[model samples]
Target: MFSGLSAFPLTPLNEKGIDEAVFVRLIERLNAAGVDSVCALGSTGSYAYLTRHERLRVAQLAVQHAGDVPVIAGIGALRTRDVLELAQDAQKAGAGGVLLAPVSYQKLSDDEVFGLFDAVTRSLSVPLCVYDNPATTHFEFSDELHGRIAQLPNVASIKIPGVPADPEAARARVDLLRALIPRHVTIGVSGDAFAATGLNAGCEAWYSVIAGLFPQIALAITRNAQAGNAREATGLSGRLAPLWALFLQYGSLRVIATAAELRGLVATPCLPLPVKSLQGEVRQRLAAILDELELA
Candidate 1:
């Protein structure tokens, strides 16, 4: 379903509300840059932070502007019913597929996790991508559990978050997923820093954050790697080392937004009250990183 660079754009906002124009521009940029797919309301989009109406608007705009690129909508929520509702809205909004992460205040058990997906799959017509993002969800998927979910009807893909700072380990993890999961299902890689390694190791796609802001660079990496120019691809990704280190230190949620803000793609950084943007020292360090990368 999702392959290559599935760009997850940052949800831009102004004091009034979500900046619709900025949202469209971001999606259009990815589409123009030839990203394989667009994932609106993904972790980078702050799906859990936005109301249903806000999330739907982002999905609608993403689908409308994506052109030939498939738009995958993130339908994650704290409860099963809410997730189901959002998934329906996403499909209705013309999203190509829906991504769901098992988010909970209370830790979810393997059976509970399976049941959540089972119920949602029963109600959905479009394919679902199991989002295994432990950083935000706090619930890790054992390979056994992911394999069980893969067997469920309508579950078409699984997103594997990479192990930052360990390229070899990340590739090994990707190898494990390909070995354990069904051959028919797609396995997409997140963690933009290590994703080049994941791609070289045989993952089908890069579900990227930087791709949202810098689709051209992201696409270059994937295209080169897929074309067997892995050394070239790795070298290109190596330029993003400083930024990746920042993401690991503070978090991509912060660093990506800060980068987007500096790039003039958005009027403000990743937003709304309560969500911290960037600070003094950190902002200074980010500036140096951006300058080194020569990103405007």
Candidate 2:
């Protein structure tokens, strides 16, 4: 379940609440694309903004509509108690695995982060993926800390941030983590732009944002890299350099939400409040890029 492309679809919202019908369509699209797994409530899914009830329903909808694709639900929360509750809810919602970022309002020490995973894993029957997304979590996981957490029961994968761009450095970074964690715990790389590099460097999975809306292109990169066609995979990723640049400038969530809107996969301003849709010239540029890349 943790060894290939995991698509993180956006949880579209309307004024009433979660746009369940649209969200289900997104999941079904991923299923038809044959993605290895569907990750609901991920950072791209705006998990942090949704209420517990909304998140539970999103997980249920994902699992229910994903058919045979394994559903990995995000169970992150600011409080451990709430995280525990959400983890249980996700399990009950039939998630095959859960992704957990160390969400916090205050800076967390390594021990506190470790304790969070320990507590959650103890109660979780489903496998847990350590979501090392420092960009949003505001807490970085030291290699040693990751090693410690990987030892816990049900720790199945570590979703590391992007690797070094240089090939040798990327491999060394992945190799160092591989040596630290148990062999069974796969290393999945986030940061969509780094997918090809990380996969070519030995990461077993790609937890992708772009894959949510454009699964076929993302799958081509994954398949090529896994088949030892490094040049082909890197070439494929390079073809979308303009899109990656946009991601760098505006953040992936906003950019992808904008793309979803342009593609008519979801309504305009599909993102939650405080996160307005991309506007003005940037949105136009995005559309042009998507057209040029044949993604639209």
* Candidate number with greatest lDDT: 2
- Candidate 1 per-residue lDDT over residues 208-240, each given as its tens digit: 999888888899999998898888988999988
Which portions of model 2 show Cα errors greater than 4 Å? none
User: What's the CA RMSD for each of the models?
Assistant: 1.5, 0.6
Q: Please, what is the TM-score per model?
A: 0.95, 0.99
Taking the tens digit of each residue's C-alpha lDDT, what string does model 2 give over 1-296?
99889999999996569888999999999999999999999999999999999999999999999999999999999999999999999999999999999998999999999999999999999999999998899998999999999999999999998999887899999999999999999999999999999999999999999999999999999999999999999999999999999999899999999999999999876988888779999999999999999995
Clashing pairs in 1: none
Candidate 1 at residue 72, lDDT?
93
